[model samples]
Target: MARTSGDDMSAGATTPAARAEALIRRYFEACNAADRAGLIDCFTPDAVHYFPPGLPSAPWRSAEAIADGWVWCVKTLGSRWTIEKVLAGADGHEAVIEWTHWKTSVNEVLRGDEWYIFNDDITRIIEIRAYYASPVNKADRVNSLHGFDYAGRGYHLDPPTPDLD
Candidate 1:
């Protein structure tokens, strides 16, 4: 079956959370489709986007700038996004999303989270703050970690408890 962004998601975006998620999904889908107009519609006229924690990014000031940013990312830099999780606030005016961005231009995968603050009517995003996560080098930090055993060679988080039925 041929997959499309709009068709991939479920129908009936009735709830505020669902609607917010739908808006975000639509934004990504528009980017995937290279729909410039669609991308601009996802944000408010005076939208703002920021990359926090030392990612040198110019704040996108308006909807046009946001659209241009994404267009440049996808077309010029060859970036793609795969959304992992979306946690909506109780009021449905805010959402935090975990996503993986494949930056083909730099041959890097950025695992990050973004906080989306919706407009008063929940129609579009007013602000987006992104945080990029990076793993610490084993040899860099010398400190006793307070957590589960990390002595044995090759230790990982416990796998899910098996449910043998």
Candidate 2:
């Protein structure tokens, strides 16, 4: 089963994976806030970060690696991360989380969703994979004051309404 995050602002239990996800969310927020230390807390010291070619390598193979790469991504993107969805589970010792990243750049919005897929059973992230696309024609655009302005940069969460689906 998959689930979307950003809900129960005041009446929900914070599971371990949930805390991890929250930390990940705050990591992005820290990037936006330009708080270097805060962003580094989201990853393991030996964490490995991968992105498409031509993009700089985000390797958190060590604490220093995390610091270096995390800073670079924050600076390079010139943007912050917005998690549109997050689903977490466990395998052996790993907690796996699948999620979507919404970002903006030069007034253009982009959407990227990933299934953190792999042998990440030591923590809570099972796998890591994603897909990104344009938001120019999305149905929500008409009333989206956020506009075509990078996806989720200035966006904040509204309490989750009853899930009708």
Candidate 3:
């Protein structure tokens, strides 16, 4: 039996799952290089991205909405975004990715996962969401945009305590 375009992932120049992964890689590469246009190009015009920490109840519903919000975050937050792991679904429609956003000052590091749902043939990302966790710091005020705070008095900032609570 001959394989269809979706069936033989290796045969074609474009496969749904492969394209999604490639687009994802390019997105992060552009982020690392600070290419705003390239970053924006990865999404569909109607794509939605949600910063889970910032808005637990609401999500950025459009590319423009997300871009407007991303401006400030990118300006003050200096970091390299990289995918640590990726698992593409067998259906070639969705993927789960483990990624890291590491910053220099305060040596802040956020480890997270993203779930991507492609719009068509992985060429456009229709829905993307990320969830990450980092240590809490008192000086964290200047270091974070999320406004995280610790309650205890013995709190130390040198090496932030893990979020085991």
**Best model per TM-score:** 1
Pairing residues by index, what is the TM-score of model 1?
0.72
Across residues 1-165, which tens digit of lDDT does each residue of candidate 3 receive?
112111333324365566666667767655656566776787788888766655543587776665554544455655555465667765557887866565644357565668888875667678888765444444553233254442232222233222223
Better of 2 and 3 by TM-score: 3
Please give, for residues 63-149, the per-residue lDDT of candidate 1 as tens digits: 898888888887775667756567777677998886666555655555567899998778898999877654522353222234524
Q: How would you encode candidate 2's per-residue C-alpha lDDT over 1-165 as one tens digit per residue?
A: 233444432223255454545444555455555566764555555555554333445323444565566466455644445555565453332323433332333333445554443234233223233344434444442223344453344333331222233
- Candidate 1, after superposition: displacement of residue 93 in Å? 0.3
C-alpha local distance difference test of each model:
0.67, 0.44, 0.58
Sequence-dependent TM-score of model 3: 0.65
Candidate 1: residue 62 lDDT (0-100): 91
Q: TM-score of the candidate numbered 2?
A: 0.52
Task: Give the distance in Å from residue 101's predicted Cα in candidate 2 to where it truly belongs.
Answer: 5.9
lDDT of 1: 0.67
Off by over 4 Å in 2: 1-14, 58-60, 90-105, 115-165
Q: By the lDDT metric, which is better: model 1 or model 3?
A: 1
| Best model number under lDDT | 1
How does each model score on TM-score?
Answer: 0.72, 0.52, 0.65
- lDDT ranking of the models: 1, 3, 2
